[model samples]
Target: MSNRVINILVPVISILLGLLVGAIVMLFSGYDPVNGYIALWNGIFGDSYAIGETIRQISPYILAGLAVAFAFRTGLFNIGVEGQLMVGWFAAVYVGAAFELPMIIHLPITLLAAALAGALWGLVPGILKATLRVHEVIVTIMMNYVALHVVNALIKTVSNGSYKTEKIQPTASLRSDFLSNLTDYSTLHYGIFVALAMVIVMWFILEKTKTGFELKSVGFNENASQYAGMNVKKNIVLSMVISGAFAGLAGAMEGLGTFGSMTSLGGFTGIGFDGIAVALLGANTPLGVIFGASLFGSLKYGANNMPNAANIPLEIVSIVVALIIFFVASGYIIRVGLQRLKKKKEAK
Candidate 1:
């Protein structure tokens, strides 16, 4: 079989295996897998509202997944997406609340602030990794806590004892009345258009641009790329900066589109963490990440209705999602199996 064929088969088979195992587990636990999945499907697709909500939830996941995937393609582990996202969220909201301008200027400025904040947050770890030879994973993980506390403190100071900032100016909001009316007042917003545009932008950059080639080549082999006269260190830092920009845009989606305000969090939002799983499941590609995010988003939206409809635990959905991720992570085993099967057919 061709490698492309194998690539497609692997993820498909992994998804099937995950669903099969999930069904078995549900059955063993005295729950009807049929009804459970039916409930899930209905929740995601039964009506326009469900569909809109699923898309709304998945929009940020797509951006977050892209953030992680972009870093992975450049041979970097950006565990700091969570922190970057938080800072971006705060920056966007702060700008939106503090400034008053026309929509044309106000919206772009707020979004750009988020992207810059996220990029700056990511650049620190990238610089450390390149100049100081520090492990990005550790630095990023530590930075997550630092960002959380710093943002929490800032919000508290400005919030007049509240845990969140005041509502953003109307011009800075991403809400669209047309989309809301179409979706039956669901939380779906104009951010989906931005998310989709980013997907296309990412695909173009990675597949059709020279900068993308340099980044991917460095990820594939840094020493070889350097020997070939590419600035490996520069590419590494640039890659992280680009990846963080995507993550910061994700925060903008939440701040400007979903909430229109910034809130103090007691803990992480987990969106960035989920991006790790998403990138893995999607094989670290822009197009694949959209599918992965859709699947995850559907499962998340569906899980809400599963308990009331099936009397099953919500954790079951999480377990199934985890199993899917595990199967995707172990894809090498599936690839080997496919290779053996191909060899047998060729021998005949």
Candidate 2:
């Protein structure tokens, strides 16, 4: 089989294996796997509200996946997306609640503020990596804590020691009355359009731009790119900034669309961490990220129905997701097995 075919086949096979394993686990636990699966399916697609909510949930995942995928493409592991997203959320809400500009200006400015905040947060680790050879993973992990504490402090300062901020003004909101009504009063918003636009932007930058070539070349080999007259350090920093911008946009989805406010968190949101899985499942491609995000979003949203509809525990869905991720991570083994099978067929 061709490499492209193999690439596609790996994930498909992994998904099937995951579901099969999940079924076995359900059987061992004395629950009906069929009912669990049916509940999962219905939760995602049973009603207009469910579909709308699923789409809303997916919008941020798409951006989060893009953030991680962008960094991976440029040979960077940005674990700071959670921190960046937190800061972005705070920045967006701050702007949205403070300003009273017209919709055309207020919304764009609020969104831009969020992206800028994320980019700035990402810049520190990028600079350290490029100039001092510090490992991004270590720096980013520490930064996550910094972002969390700092944002929480800022929230309390702004909200007079409250845990949440004020709701954003109407002009800065992404909510759409028409869409809400169409979806039976779901929280779906215009953030989906922004997420889709960024997908195209990522594709264009990676596939059609000169900067993209330099970034990829640098990622493949810094020494070789430098020898070929590319600015490796610059590309590295730029890649992180761009990745951070995508992460920030994800925060905007929550602040400007879903919640229209910011809240102090006792712990991590897990969305940024989930981006790692999404990027892995996507094969680190722009188009692939959407598919990964959709699968993840649907599974996460649908998982809620298992308990109510099938008497199955919610933890079962988590186990299934974990198994799926494990299979995806074991793609090398699958590929090797496929290659051996192909060789045997050719020998015959």
Candidate 3:
């Protein structure tokens, strides 16, 4: 079989295996997997509201996945997406609430603030990695904590000790009454359009640009890229900045679209961590990230109905998702097994 076929088959096979394992677990636990899945499906697609919410849920996941995937392609592990997202969220909300400009100017400015904040957060690690050879993973992990506490403190300061910020100005909000009414008053917004635009942006940058080639070349071999006269350190820093910008847009989606305000969080939102799985599942491609994010968004939103509709634990869905991620992570094993089987068939 061609490698292209195998590449396609891997995710399909992994999903099937995950569902099969989930079924077995459900059987052993005395629950009906069929009903559980049906409930899950209904929860995601039973009505227009469900569909709208699922799309809304997917918007942020797409940007987050792109952030992680971009870093991965650049040979960097950015574990600080969560931190970057929080700072972005705070920045966007601050601009939205504090300003009173028209929508054309206000919305763009709010979004820009978010992206800038995220890029600045990412720049620290990028600079450290480029200049001092500090590991991005460690630096990013520490930055997540810094972002969390610092944003929390800022929120308190802005709101006078309140846990939430004031409502964003209407002009800056991504929410649309038309979309909400179309989807039975679901919290749907124009953020999906923003997410889709970034998908194209990522694709165009990686597949059709010289900077992207340099970035990928650096990722493949720093020494070789340096020998070729490419600025390795510059590429590294640029990659991180772009990746951070994507993460910041994700936070903007939540603040400007879903909630229209920033809230002090007691813990991480888990969106950034989930992006790792999303990137893995999508094979770190822009188009694949959409599919991965859709699946995750559906499962996550639909899991809420399992307990009520099928008496199945919500944890079952989590297990299934985890198993899918495990299989994706172990894709090499599946590829090897398939290749061996092909060889045996050829001999026969």
Model 2 C-alpha lDDT per residue in residues 1-348, reported as the tens digit of each score: 777888779878888888889889889988999998899889999999999999999999999999999999989999999998999999999999998999999999999999999999899999999999999999999999999999999999999989999999999999999999999999999999999999999999998999998998898899999999999899999999999999999999999999999989999888888888888888899988998899888888988888999999878778976776678667778988988887888899
Candidate 1 lDDT score relative to the true structure:
0.89
Write the candidate numbers in order of decreasing lDDT: 2, 3, 1
What are the Cα lDDT values of the candidates?
0.89, 0.91, 0.91
Root-mean-square deviation per candidate = 1.8, 1.6, 1.7
TM-score of each: 0.94, 0.95, 0.95
Best of the two (1, 3) by TM-score:
3
**Candidate 1 C-alpha lDDT tens digits along 1-348:** 988999889888987897789889889888998998888788899788888888899988998999999999889999899999899999999999999999999999999999999999999999988888899999899988998999999898888888989999999999988888898888899888888899998889889999999999999998999999999889989998999999999999999999999889989999988888878778899988998888777877877877888888977877866776678678889999999999999999
Clashes of each: 0, 0, 0
For this target, which candidate reaches the highest lDDT against the unseen true structure? 2
What is candidate 1's CA lDDT for residue 25?
A: 84
Distance from true position, residue 301, model 1, in Å? 1.8
Once superposed on the true structure, which residue ranges of model 3 sit more than 4 Å away at CA? 1-8, 328-332
lDDT of 2 at 329: 65
